[model samples]
Target: MNTNKSGPQENIDLGNSKVVNIRDKFDNKTKEILAKRVGYLCSNPDCKNTTSGPHTDPKLTINIGVAAHITAASPGGPRYDSSLTPSQRRDSSNGIWLCQNCSKLIDSDTNYYSKDLLQGWKHNAENHAKQLIERELNQGWATTLPEYFESLISLELTTSPPIGRNIGQSSDGQFWLVLWDSRNAKYQWSKITEKYAEQELQSVCKYRNVTNWQDLFEK
Candidate 1:
């Protein structure tokens, strides 16, 4: 008889690997850990998509990155940056918990948040809201959009009387998914920001590889 010694998974060893370019630390460990903390999804107030990976256009950790440090490091630190040399780096408070899209928004402008909103958001992330891009911005009249909108105008929303996520028959008598499109309501994934059942997502959860919400919810 013969046996082989156990070896660690390649992803788990990312913290010590020398291949920085080839191996993404965040994907290997940091993402795994942070996802657990933030419920394996975007931490935005209303958005609720499970995060498959971590991002570092802003660095969260030195290696096995999860949260990006808003401030750049010194010349010879874990991630040296010439551009950051002149400017003072910010502390963790300056950093925001963002998904890939939100991270881009932050980089696009120094004044990303409204002055009144920014101060309140910084005071506590719980008070903040996830801002969508122009395309998905809450607006009116789109020639091409989801068909479910039409059904929503007429269909009133109702929950299953607070089973688990139902939160108990909303205080407003009933909880219904309102179709903003007001054109077609056959099927539309509403509230991309808030955490939702896997099935609630359209193509967004393409990687989920699950047949329906039960796949993740039963867990």
Candidate 2:
């Protein structure tokens, strides 16, 4: 007779005190939440590695982020928690987003990565993403031409849309134009004078949309 009590199959025990072929799997919803919550970046503070990027195939993207459990999903595994229910084991709150390398490293060095420490990492990563989004929103529109260009690139990696608009005079006092792309929401800007930039931006709002050039300056 199998003495092992029934539970999630991932940590099942065979007869005669033998535990074999255990597995713990996170549901698709849990996986999605873990990845999205951390902005698809590795949760390691020192690494801060990008988990997804443009792939060699132009039409494809690569994702390397892993949702690793804070406590092992199965018995006899690193940081294994026999006390947790199967549902609790697979919860998003019990997971952390990590790069492939960091995932292996944590599991191998279980002594250093306690459940509490992994929870702290998760908290920090999510808070970091939230702060970046807040900064982008609070920045409003860029006031100067140079500031506009810089802000556009700086915000591309964060959760914000990274859309910025600016109209200002340059050092030479030429009219500066910065437009947001309606199709893709990309920030488009040019250092050339107003006449040259009109053709480049190809804006539908060119002549009919403006009250006055002087009134367009973004603060």
Candidate 3:
């Protein structure tokens, strides 16, 4: 069936599929779970974009995400599976959280984005959500991993004698480790020295009274 663009208006053929009458819609609970499963970010691994944010108007909010179906929501549409029941078609397992751009991109290229691949994306998104929840439950790190890591890298670039580079986590899950080295006026770092760096980082943290070397994973 043709995709619905505007309210109750006539369905327009978007040239991807032939227009039909049936419409498979997801219920509220399913939609909510789909959004939460990905932590409200685009499921596309290359585009983990946050879908919602503060709006220009303080009282409003902006959302650029969509809960797209792995299989077409209606028959005669892209990736429509005739084998699935109507209820199965609308199930949360069939949905993927995605930015508006990625949503359209997947629908536009059904050949490349198969149901199995989309399902894998959904699984990956859920795994990421689990990791996020675990991180949040831990004594609340100051920032997300990527953000914190990028900031550390930035600090490494600007500093002259990048010493004291290390990685360490607090007993309460506060993980922050960074160090840089400027040898012979040339920059050298231990981004690859993760194993050794951890040992050094813990020693540094202990020296600074930051956190001990005990196994404190009881959170």
- Number of the top candidate by TM-score? 3
Question: For model 2, where is the 10-residue window of minimal lDDT?
Answer: 148-157
TM-score of each: 0.26, 0.55, 0.57
lDDT of each: 0.35, 0.67, 0.66
Q: Which structure is stronger by lDDT: 1 or 3?
A: 3
Best by lDDT: 2
Where model 2 places Cα greater than 4 Å from the true spot, the runs are 1-19, 140-219
lDDT of 3: 0.66
The worst-scoring run of ten residues by lDDT in candidate 1 lies at: 161-170
**Model 1 agreement with the true structure over 114-146: per-residue lDDT tens digits:** 323433433334222222221244343223333
**Tens-digit lDDT track of model 2 for 130-195:** 655544764532222242232221212223343545443555556555655444544444566767
Alpha carbon lDDT at 96, candidate 1 = 37
Candidate 1: Cα lDDT at 14: 59
Name model 3 segments beyond 4 Å from true.
1-19, 140-219
| Candidate 2 Cα lDDT to native | 0.67
lDDT of 1: 0.35
Ranking 1 against 2 by lDDT, winner: 2
